[model samples]
Target: MENLNNNEYQKFADKKVPKPTYLKNVILAFLVGGAICTIAQGVTNFLESQGYNEDLCGMGTSIVMIFIGSLLTGLGVYDKIGKVGGAGAAVPITGFANSIVAPAMEFKREGFIFGVAAKMFIIAGPVLVYGIGSSIIAGLLSILFKG
Candidate 1:
């Protein structure tokens, strides 16, 4: 009787196990991520052709991408895109915007100061800290080595 029960449980567990689609998911992520980078590159190239210097072109491209990301988030569309794109929707400047906007939108009901404003940095705060910290360290190293 115990053997039969064990066999039944094993069968149930086997049926419940999900087959992994890792390769397919990886391909989707890669394609989507590559597409995003290509779009950014196109924007940069267009700006450069319009007489913008390297700095201006880079900044302009970043602004455009961030704006698009924020707009999609505000319209409740970034989530859908993220679902389909996975990390393809992430690992870019747009992902940073989504990270900031998503939490703020989620907590908007708790009041502005306590909710949206506070939650807006849920992801961005740590990034800002690490970014600034790393820049500072790099700058100090550069100065030290400039002799």
Candidate 2:
């Protein structure tokens, strides 16, 4: 094992590593992402048909999608979807819900306050912080440039 030099060892290791299926992964991600968007659009359409105002329809659609994501995560289905869909499943609002719920579920053995609540935001905290921060910065810039 110690006989080979760095260059030889690197070449051996590179050959041993499996190559990724880039085209297949891309197709799966595109299909899964499109499916998620289709479901969300269906929800929005249904809400709109029920006489919901545009704002309410948007809010309701978000709520339903989040609930579906959290439910799927709890039921152990979302993880499978994530494995297959890769970033496709992780880029939507449903994926955001999964991120929030997944850590909480994993740490629930520690108790509600320290486990569930504390770990709940572990994944989504940075996202929320940066998202809100960026929005605030953008708003300020917009106002400044409004002259």
All candidates' lDDT scores? 0.90, 0.96
Worst 10 residues of 2 by lDDT: 1-10
Q: Model 1: per-residue lDDT, tens digit, 18-67?
A: 97688987888788788888999999999999999999999999999999
Clashes of 2: 0
Expressed as tens digits, the lDDT of each residue in 1-147 for candidate 2 is: 677699988998999999999999999999998999999999999999999999999999999999999999999999999999998999999999999999999999999999999999999999999999999999999999994
Residue-pair clashes per prediction, in order, are 0, 0
Cα lDDT for residue 83, model 1? Answer: 82
Q: Give me the runs in candidate 2 sitting further than 4 Å from their true place.
A: 1-12
Q: Against the true structure, whose TM-score is highest?
A: 2
Q: List the residue pairs that clash in candidate 2.
A: none
